[model samples]
Target: MKLNKAFTLIFLSFYSFSKLLAQTDETYLFPINPGNKNYLAGTMGELRSSHFHAGIDIKTGGQEGLPVYATKRGYISRIKVSTSGYGNALYMLHPDGNTSVYAHLREFSDEIAKYVRAAQYENKTYEIELFPDPYEFAFQRGDVIAKSGNTGGSTGPHLHFEIRDEQQRVLNPLHYGFDEIKDNIAPIAQRLAVRPININSRVENRFDRKDYYLSRYGVNYAINDTITAFGKIGIELLGHDKLDGAANQNGISTIEVFVNDEKYHSQIIDVMSFSLMRDIIVHYPYDIKVNKGRTYHNLYVDNGNRLNFYESKANNGYLNIEADSTYHIEIKMYDPYGNISTVTLNIKGKAPAKQIKERIDFELDRISYQVEKNILKVFTRENCEEDANKELSIYINDSIKTVLPAYFLNNVAVYLWDLHEGIPTSVLSCNKGVNISINARAIPHQATVINAENFIVNFPQSALYDTIYVSTAYEVRTQDSLEVFSIEPVTVPLKSSFYVSASPQFSHYQKDKTHVYQTDDAGNFSFVGGSWSGETIQFNHRSMGEFTLVTDDTPPVIRPATEKNYYYISDNLSGIASYTASLNGEWIMMRYEPKLRLVWIEWPEGMQNKRGNFELKVKDNAGNETIYTTKL
Candidate 1:
């Protein structure tokens, strides 16, 4: 058995060594200064509004035509120019199969720029995609290829640099030995909070309870007092980390916590999917009033939620402060390059106390909404849903308000509420089948248009004349002609003083009961079927107007070198293929199975991808195409 184990270990070590050797050889040998600029607008693996930033933003300082160079030996495999997204983008394929992308470019190298300009003039359009043969434009390391500028969706002048695999998956550039960046400053601990969410119904500190607070006594962070609770409790914190030499404070790259020397929770702000951005809400503490944004990097794993990011076991981030006499809590934060900072906290256990003087109500001190005093006197608002079913107490200036009954709507509740001096009054449960209306028009507020139908409405001063009301679920009904309502525009000039009503645009969405149509900016009302010329029309979801059909049976041409024989999984590979499909005016989802070299498609749930002999087009990343036709 010992001999077998020894042999197995030897084999694994050899494989691991080989992999490391390959990675080192693939590293960039020389620095390619994105430009001769020191300013940066963004960095690799930064937390962003919707997604984790994939690349580094090299600052252009609002200037244009600064030269960009190839980081390694690579060929120009793909070029795309568009009004949005990348504006003018170039893809370079490297020998290691990685692709480097430069986006928001003002112009390409002279040779490529001329080619693109010619194509643009010929097509009479700004958008164009080109795939030149491999011999067209190959560059050695440190060769200039493009110049940085503001284009597409960029708000200012900067260059977006990305390293991606052949599958188009972005790889963290910092992990590949991009040695220019450095980070050593520790993260700041802003607030430490605790909640007995599911423990005892009443979450008040007894004589034996412990409270945690943030204190700045040590070099980084330390806790002076201990916390002890009898039952179940959860912890939340607000904090941010700093990178050396950067003005901005960014999210901590990783956080791990230890309770009683046992691993509890771990969280890392690294790569993420575009589709799960909305799940951020569930991961963070949702403040009832202000929506105070938490980092959304929850270290504690919740039941049944399959978020695949943690690398630790035994919940290295959540602490269970039980009846032990004393417990030690340690928190460690790490930057992207693995520099670590830690804080140690001590917690002691105690028994529950019986009766004691009631502390200040946490709800009154925590929840807040900004409103004018005069607004509550005249204007009232209806709460279509129970403002609080979590049994949270409502109070103003330390006085306890009346508690109201709960009414459910489709499992939700309908209640009446009033806001005075930025605080909501005790909820008022209403009877079924009754609609309570409140007039908000009397409130001094302004409104501005948003999109085509919605608007931003802002309340300036409180007014009693405006009222809000609550209504039962049955009060709503279907209609053949839906009258859409939006908050009237407030005649105010300042952007800060304007707001819009909730649900600003309404349409009769019931397919069998109502008809609602909308016209675009061009005054063309589009039906599911096609464009219609009318000031008014009954919108039908099922009926796509009408169309003519043409048939062609010629199969799309598929290329070999760029399509059939291409292999390599690097961030820089750009090869493409194209084809065309025709139908009787329908919608479809295109699927390409590379292994089978076949294309399969399905219509959108309620729509079809069809046009009378429409062009069935397919294109690859490198701009290759194969156009074929199926006859009707």
Candidate 2:
């Protein structure tokens, strides 16, 4: 069975490699800048917040409504209109077993726009996904299909384009021949980090990671400072790439590391599967990215990172250093167009230190903690002989307590506890206790629960991308009887949504008007409709952050803006849920942009002059309703 499994794996690997080779040979024009008149804003396989950028972003001169063209002759397969994420997008199926996507469109072409508008009226919703017949909207190659816009989650005016296979695996658009996009600039290796993998391992005589600056020599670079390393170590680099005629930096395609002339590690991000996109959290150092805002690609494979974009030898590129031994390292960063930048380093391994002396300085009011992978690390000041035997009292919510001994570190006694067992609400030691801290340790592919006095969090078995310490607390209650709940470490991404069941502490006078909402940093409330089962209210939350229960007594505001062509409809809380507009008691087609809080009518060709008793009714998420009636 083992041999057969290995054979299957090898065959699949070869088939995938051959499929990629064939994909590159296929031809597609650039979606924007067909004549090479513009530069790209993003590259395929770039690391983006929450997920990998599935495609390329074509710059539109920082303006919207630019004509976007079809790269190849294909038929419309899908169309999506929404208030978020790829607003007004189109998908086409070509003859080459590939699907082309154009997103953030200002408007579709004449015929396509008409079809989409009709669909919206038929469904009576601004957000809709529709599938058209295979040849319903076929067009020739290089034909103008839509106009680009800075809609949805886009920060600026650009067209987000993508090429994917029938299986939905995203392919690099740069692979296809596109003379429009040019790149000759090599990637820049900004900084290098060497990490000690084991307790006894040290880099520069410290158990923590040490970062080095790079000295440039032409297109190549080198680390000028002499480095000392001991025991097992892993490497990471912070680097970026640039294209010709553009100074904006994006993701690099590949990085190859060699130890003394032998290939040890290679990371290539040519293709990424959407099913495994969230694995990005494990691809880089999660703690560093969240706390330091720096993305450093690991030169070594990490735990639970199943991204099929790496190749390495011997323990996934972790170099085990011995006392008095010397090692040479070479790192090469490559762009998709074959431009390369190199960096070199030399390390001398010194004898490992035993019983190292260090001063301790810190308050034990709150235990300092950093969760690296699944291990729960707590830092505390180390004092006298009794401090060496101090153990952390893990206070589980169910009254069970587990004590873990103090581990090693120079200035602090680090308590390294494996969180696979469970998570604790608080950890206590010597007279000091961490309150309302790590609620429970959530492991990927396993269900976990965090029970508290005010609420209980239920994590689905597939809730996590990687093992993380789930933190939750009832931050505070407002005067309006609103309870703000913090379920945090908002930086980590989840594979599945978690369920929150909470008991209400505030007055329930307006029980029927109450619902949960996710609050952003800007104080905007996104209604996450929840249901109450007696005393406990339950809701599904997609992301980790602040959640609150709001009683929205105020109805949606609907006021005339432009006589009859437009209306300003907004809700103070628990945002607008449903709306309807009528001309003389007859339904009319109305278009809306939620982000702008504007609603208007695109009157049918002949209905502009005929207007009577105009009425518009809008409702908020908590069932509050408002109506505006006027005559034209």
Candidate 3:
């Protein structure tokens, strides 16, 4: 039996590779319509908040229930259903050692749907993941597999599709033979930015970087003038792509930078691994933090970025210009269809300008902290030109903890503390009330606990990626009837989710209506559900920010958008969680678009003109439910 199993595995691997070669020779059909027009809403390697988008988003004409077909002969390998992220997703493992994913689906085909429903009932949960045997389900190319819909984290109706190799690396779907889809439009360059990378460097006689709006000139964009710079400098481009008929702006496919007509850096978005997705932030970290709705590509690669998309970087794409000279810079942007756009600029290298150091005033609001390795690095905007050689005191629990000498890097004052020494208790404060309370074990590899008057925080050894000093505090807003707990600062990124248990002052009657919420920098609260245990509420969060206990008693409101049947649904406090609509006693399919706050059901075929009693039920995250009944 063991010998037979090994022989079977070898045969399957060989068969899969053979199928892969055949498909590469243009034997497979498009996953959707083969002859109809198809547009892409997003592309592989698109930069997202913390990760790169690993697949393509195919437009579904802003509607749901579009038939999704199998791209090749494959077996149903995996199926996942969830309320968030890729709801109702299906994965197919082809004989070619590749897997095709269909996400945000409305429903599967009849046979697959039956299987899924039975599994859901057996598991007794709406969210589920299942892996079926290879012989359980199989399909040929062009077989209808599922129907696309707007589900999960989707902002609109589109099909999120992916093609992955046997090792699970996502490959650009466009690389496959989808020759019928047409895109002749080129990417557009909007702006260019130049930054002084070194402390001795200056851009246009200023220490800070400058952004220049680019205007179209013939086939290329130009800054229209030369930029004066000294020492090492880096560049950034703001650009996006557009398909022939789609109005949605998509990510560019490739970028190449040249200096003096020589290739300095290039990035081709054809493949990506799941582990390298987080490096999207490092590629354009500043832009990712500040820009919303725009795509910014950094011409330079950071020293720590490990993404494989970048290639042939000369000094990581930074131009070192110490002497008087002139250098020509050119950038080429491309779309998946081979359409290209070019931009050109000139950098005039000159002598460094006179340096006049100014003293920086340390403000309480400007102080922040970062954790790198085992060092707790404190950053302040205040220039410490004179204080660089001076020692500053760090207080823990209102007592003098230790004194560390300040250091200056690029005009900013920074202080570093080694966590291997010891972990402080209660509060960590420097001068001017810049303090935060932290649990000792909050840093990874360390064990610590924190107990305050109203909250208790427990940190596991794996909760952090590095050693960090954490600060927390509690506040009561009597006027707003809120109990706020300042967890950790937002600048610190958490590697693993942490637990927080807080005892907020609330009445027993508010138990069902009360839940924990995370607040943004603007003081706006978003629901973060918690479990109530006696008087304490416990929750786990992946981000550091302010949290509060909020009571939401109002039920969700459902308003009819169309006089015939459509309804506009909304919630005043906690967002909508679950909704259902039924005719008589049978449940009917209701298409919900949370972004548009619209919900409606298609008139059932053969019963389009039938009139009956309709009941709609909507529930919020806080357990508030509202029901509406009316004659259709």
Candidate 4:
């Protein structure tokens, strides 16, 4: 690799910043920079695929081997190295009852590196974790602990740093006064949303949520439209934050909502618990995130959201608008530096019309239903003029469980069922039968077991944040050329995990080649390793989706090293399980990063043999292996 002059200058500046940190006396020095403006690639509370980001990411100028320093006098309490998730991480326990963490490291300091290698060799595994004695690997403030690199789940070269309280709650690193960082820019409001709480509620005279555009001028934002809403309504927002010297967007520090000059909602993301991190799914608009790829922080508490960071004065962060009343709405966002951006809008309440809506037109025999936030809304076609007040029946295992009166929405008869009571097997209305499709009800705070014809699922008591209406169907064939057990409504996600056991639908699949797979919307397969007991294979999974049982006899592909730096690249359809590298029939260390599908040699004890026989062995998750050999 080569670097332009500008890139070379930035690389030099990164090293200079590290050298400056080595002399700093600050109580909590920036891990990679001190006495200068520290750039960030990401911030605490940023939204991730599964949870909120636990820490801040310090930029390393697109280069590796930047020295990472200890922010406080502490001992290395824990160290971990793995192919995924914060590869090469170090945790230090300080005297002040707080823990500091540095992740995505290239290598530890000299003594720590030696210790990690000896333990890895002794354990005969590249990935390992160690808890040292209380006083081992102790260091003073500003002492180098490791060098930053792109490892683990990192997308680029940066250092992931964090601070945690004694209870393991992730605290915002910016809460500790670090002069190495400076930000004066206010967060920018991306979009504003208002939700109609119920059927009686309306936003802009429509019984649905509405999104409004925002305009900004420095620290102020405005919604140009005067929103017309009635009954109960709530607000949400999407936004990003900026720092002075970095061209990166980050998470806002705080979000507050005000109605009629009184504070209605407030949430400050200063600390987070890993145990409760999945509450992010409910804290934000999950549907909007899944559909639009935008994370909108709710200005009101959502159902099943159990986070403790929200504070409000009254009415649980909702506005009750009466007829002919005007309410001024304001949303304020704050960055860690106290920079403020205020968004303002106005709402006027109006009474709904008493006249019946225009008759809707739809196919007379169509019926469908989906669950949202534990409410099952069933839509069925109905006659427009002749007796629209029909009763819909709910059935459980071929028995009539209950009946619900019809409500008309868009000329369609609708039935609503609160799933907390129980899940129904099917719904009947207007001479049409709508199967609920769910196999069982997995409720929170209790273990649920379901043994169906094709598969058996064991739902742990902790597997659900709320009730899940479980549904599954078997398909004999699909594009994957395998037997599929489709789990309907993959839209609803589980906070924890559940175990699923199933016997192979086909007898031809051998136990060795047979593995369970979770399929995506596009029909791609991700290997879910399973253990067999007789003919049943069981696996633990955190998601509800289409599962397939098939034989994978393909081996991983090993790409030749494109660089002269002894790099080896490899990939597999079922995912790489493990790999090993040896030179001259002697074991040597190989660093593997799965994200890039690359593995590189790390010589032991500084061995520099000019000529040798080298072999790399790679294995796929399905037990297929590939070997590559070369003479150097």
Candidate 5:
């Protein structure tokens, strides 16, 4: 029996070593040239507006037509072409059950281009996605597959590269031999924060969290003094990583929390699914909503978040702070290259302040409205226990229409009103206008609708994921070029697209150029395409914000950035829609950077003469066109 046990120990050790060896042995050539002076504009697992950036953005010297090579011996398995999102992308599947993706390409190789063009013409559309057989377009290692460019959602000229497992989960390419990209700098912690996790809890004697700005001390970061907290509390760190010689601050690859020298929680961003991208909100939702420029990583896991990146064997990173105890806390942040930065602090738990129970008056902060079938569901945060069996007033267009009894749900008030009788002009609660209407038959589920003098909104049942009280209003801006219909308080989130129809006064010639646009809080407009049906312009949009009608008839302006090299092009009203360039009457590739309003062509190899007549043409979304010709 001792001999058997000895054998089992040896076998286990050998198996563990073998697994580590296999992981290190799995090799991949650099997708882009490692020797090139390329820097990553975006890192894997970087936090974005609505999702985590799934890939790395490899800079191409701010130019296009750089040869993109395959990382391994693989066959082109999928090809997609579109005006947005990875404009022209290719997916190559290798024998090791991993796929490499190259996106935003200027053009494919000769053979693949021929096949894709033929398929595009046959299908009669510029956007196409095809799954080719494994045997087709097989490429050996280091074969040039395509040329990188600024296409799709790219803001500049760069290649968005990705590596994925067979299950289609996006894996950080830096994990697969690309660690050769040097990064000696460590993550920098800007601030340390602690928050109360429960309603009864307090941080620094308040319900809100407290932040401590870090001061550099001896190669690491530390708070000036320890913090006093009580009850359940969570920790958060505002930090970012900097690559050597790169100006951009990127996301850290890993974060681990240690409590009294014991590993309490960890977040590893090695792989994640696109479906779980929304979980980013719950990770550090308050920070994302309040702070626009900084990223805050939450050390504790929220109850609703299902992101697989977090691992905590005990308490989900929350500390139950009890009196007469001191907890030493340490946090380690790591970059993909294993450079580590640490921050240490101490938390002294104290007994919470004594509570004095008193009679709480019922007050409503906000009212929410939703429709289910023919019943209008009204909800609000009121002290149902104190205001039990009270009557709530429902008003339509400033007139008291009915009084309904409030029902209690988990200490909150709920009221149901039947709308099968007819749609009201406007529903009111507490004498405030809560826009509510039903243009169609019974709503399938809960929804909100807004009807105004010149506009009507239909938010479908699936449009909202939570009960929302939308505040809307309209105003005409005579100072602007056209009439504007504004929707106030645009911060509300929507799950699906909602429909809006508006009647705007326009001239006969202005009709063709007029379309609905979404305006920001600062009154800047982004064109949201709409079509006219008789006198009303209707459109479907996925955001809740101010809408307006604008007519753009100005042509794009084209000027040479450099007399011999690049051109600057821009449109003041609607943005550039299409552009073409020709050298000596031969069509040349012109890479467009919409954000910078610049378009330029890389001089092809062996084209020596700089003297030539160049012609450039640009068109805006409003069909206004501009042509410029100059001698180089």
Candidate 6:
């Protein structure tokens, strides 16, 4: 009775604490080491000129195998081991129903280590993913689970710790409890830009058509020659600030912009959802021709980007400033620990100078022109082309038809007008490049076929190794032969299977009389040219190799494998076997989640096992069926 009462009170206390966390106004707390002695290699919310940094990086004394302890008490939930990404990661579920993740570990504790090693051996693979039940491995406060290490995407040794909600949305660790970090440094404002109100427009340099440094505290620039503007205009400023103890210039966490005391935009890095990762591009500008480089400006407008951090009322988070309007702009920047920095700007607007117009033959049109390495690509949609004339000394290459995004550009990054438009979607140069590998995964509507007659390529530079686009294009044959030719790069061998499309429509018979099939638009293909017989058939690709195909024609070969010893009186359901298909002949890992009462399959990139029919022509050594299909 006493134990029951104690358990009830504990549950009630936890429930109340959870409610408080939900109701709190603070978004995140610090999760730093107890002492603020460590320096940062990367900072949360810092501008990368490309992708957004997802989590806070705490320095680990510049070495691996640093003892890492749980930030809070919780039960072991998920443990994933991989060569890339978080190296070896661990997840602990707290009493408050939240999960704390510790990634890139050098090793696990003895108890957990043994369990994982056994699992790895059973699976016969170095990489493994598993979810343990609530009581599988529980840890109290400061219980050591793993040691921090530099693994998978880490250039140095550091601890990658994150806190996530029930739905797996990663919240900023600074919100939980780390208040020890001191950041008194102010944010440095690099440059202020006045955007032209037209799309595809150009900002005239006071002297030349190129970008020039501004003399501090100077107002109004006079174009040395003629130029024109297009579309809406904004500013791209390059700036970063240092923390109190760390010398690295880290990204600011909070941004608040006010135009004459009116809130124009505000963004706080409280939490992020993984499902919204692609939204990272939408958070920055993508127009490579105008903004010049990939520096993200937070105007907090939702461009259908579920970034999970933006909270805005009007026009997303974009602060659309008008041309020829005098205004006062104030921007407030903050770090995770309430460290603040402010920048104030006073501006006066004027029309394009007459000399600027004469030099560039300035015309306001709807077309957007992007310049890369002296090469220019003009983009014009149905209603996009308008009269806009801007003369700039840029190299022009008319050979390439497509373009890469600015992130891949050399020494240059372009910022577009919209938020989340900053990812590298196109090649940054027009140099000749090699098509490294082929991805045959099937996608809707954009499937490529092998033996294509024409290939469409958008090379970013004249020198190879820039970025190469390899896709097969089709053309008609005069003799009705339906022959498809190769359009891939010159270096890609014409007969290489990577250039081959995996679509069933492009299937052909091999010498062995087996049919080869294409997988999808992504170049994932399959071949049933040979029989599965009793042994597992393996498929090989350039990078992905040696996958044993799980044949539905044969039932899953099951042995006397059960969870625990059961003294059942000869029940028919005693030891059931199962088998699943794998794409590109890879292994499909499966398990039945007792808590959810559902069968779960990991890394299933191909067809599924059929339902209900559990008998087949062949059987394993223990008399398991050769082809046994069962419901998931």
Q: What is the lDDT of residue 576 in candidate 5?
A: 79
* Candidate 6 residue-wise lDDT at 618: 25
On the 0 to 100 scale, the lDDT of residue 488 in model 6 is 33
lDDT of 2 by residue, 1-632 (tens): 45687677667755654555455444687888687666888897677756788888888888999888888876788999876789889998776778899998989999998888788777766678999855678787789999999767777889999999989789988888777888889999999999987656778765668888999998999998768989889998998989987777788888999988899999888888998887777677766787689888889987667788899988887898888888889999999888999999998998755345654344543356766545566776655456665777776667756555443446466665666666666677665666546766777789988886699998999787767777777856454445788887876767679998988787654778989888876677888988989887999976788888877899989877865478999988788888888889878777777777888876654687886888888998899999988886
Whole-model Cα lDDT of every candidate shown, in order: 0.48, 0.80, 0.75, 0.80, 0.73, 0.47
Q: Write the per-residue lDDT of candidate 4 for residues 271-329, one digit (tens) a residue.
A: 99999888888788777777688888888887667899899787778788888999898
What's the count of clashing pairs in each model shown? 70, 1, 6, 0, 0, 108
Per-residue lDDT tens digits for candidate 5, residues 329-427, read 889998888788889999988765433132223454556665432346665555445445445566554565664433344444556665554455555
In model 5, what is the error at residue 162, expressed in angstroms? 1.5
- What C-alpha lDDT, on a 0 to 100 scale, does residue 279 get in candidate 4? 85
* Candidate rank order under TM-score: 4, 2, 3, 5, 6, 1
Task: State which candidate has the highest TM-score.
Answer: 4
The TM-score that candidate 6 achieves is 0.53
lDDT of 6 at 608: 47
How does candidate 5 score on lDDT? 0.73
Off by over 4 Å in 2: 1-26, 196-202, 209-211, 229-233, 347-373, 376-441, 469-492, 518-528, 559-564
Stretches of model 3 off by over 4 angstroms after superposition: 1-26, 196-201, 230-233, 286-288, 291-294, 303-306, 312-326, 349-481, 487-513, 521-523, 531-538, 553-571, 576-620, 623-632
Looking at model 1, residue 360 earns an lDDT score of: 26
- Give the lDDT of residue 598 in candidate 2: 80
Candidate 4 TM-score versus the reference? 0.86
Each prediction's TM-score against the native? Answer: 0.51, 0.83, 0.71, 0.86, 0.67, 0.53
lDDT of 3 by residue, 89-126 (tens): 99998867789999999889988887876675455445
Error of 5 at 78 (Å): 2.2
